[model samples]
Target: CLGDRAAVALSRAGHFRGRTLFSGMLYAPLVMPEVITGLSLLLLFVAISAERGFWTVVVAHTTLTMCFVAVVVQSRLHALDRSIEEAAMDLGCSPVAAFLRATVPLIWPAIAAGWMLAFALSLDDLVIASFTTGPGSTTLPIRIYSEVRLGVKPEINAICTLIIAAVTVLIVVASLAAKLSKTQADNAAPM
Candidate 1:
């Protein structure tokens, strides 16, 4: 939803294509060191916070997270069936109506999966969060960092275990949901 808007805005403005920029921004942190990503975002956060306060963090997070969202969403869009969309249009549906009704429903699973993955990634992201988070806003990864730096503790281990568990759960849930959806689609297919 937001990625499409950003891409369109960029396209209309002639600044840069959203797909290229979004892919670059999102991949930079993932490929780069945590310190670099964190430090860069930190500097950005500091400047924005000084100028705007709490909302700055939100903006920063969005900038960082939207890339991942874009990648996932883009993949979903690529896997979508264009024929269904064309058929909808031929059946008297407007282009917009076809997209809203036929296209969106078919791609809904991928869109949902992408969003969920993005959200989970944002939640687990240490480097980006460290850089982008304000002084008063520390996320779970930051808390873990502080604890580990100070000394090893059972609570830290417990927290780490929980994070791993949560990630595993999310992956399993997404996988199962996708599998079920695929099965349903296959069963409905003309055989």
Candidate 2:
């Protein structure tokens, strides 16, 4: 799954020979909003929903989320060791098996981290969510935004504190796990 994700990200990024300049240019525009991304997404939703409903919003959100995820996973793939994969292939594994066994394990943590980052981004997205969501598809970010706009309250602070705590915990745990895995791998290597 990790290799697949990394590969998909690389493929989508238009990366060739491990280059990622194209992806950076593409995503840079998206991270900022000129006209409020929500309004743009809303316009797209109206045009598309002239054809369908519930799934349209999901599709839009997935596309939006995948853009960010791909950029992250592509960077992870680029940083990976190419020699390990070549060694796996030389040992008689097929290309896919080599990627699965050698490349995937090394990059799995990055891919998992990207997934969490993407999830957090998606959860916190408000403008896009507000524009793209149908009647029944309002997300947490959208809900919170709506409430805050109406007026600030104690619950908003509670929610903000919870979000901060969760993100901090995730970052700490992921860092420790990466450090531990690198130490164990280094120790296991023949010396």
TM-score of each: 0.69, 0.72
Encode model 2's per-residue lDDT on 103-170: one tens digit a residue: 87887766776677667766766656666667755677777888999998899899999989988998
Q: What does candidate 1's lDDT look like per residue over 30-134, in tens digits?
A: 466656766776676566556433465556556666656556656666666678889999999998898889877866665676567667766767766655666
Error of 1 at 133 (Å): 2.5
Best-performing candidate as measured by TM-score: 2
Q: How much is 112 displaced in model 1, in angstroms?
A: 2.6
Which residue pairs come into collision in candidate 2?
none
Span of ten consecutive residues with least summed lDDT in model 1: 4-13
User: Could you tell me how far off, in angstroms, the CA of residue 54 lies in candidate 1 after the best superposition?
Assistant: 5.1
In model 2, what is the error at residue 94, expressed in angstroms?
1.4
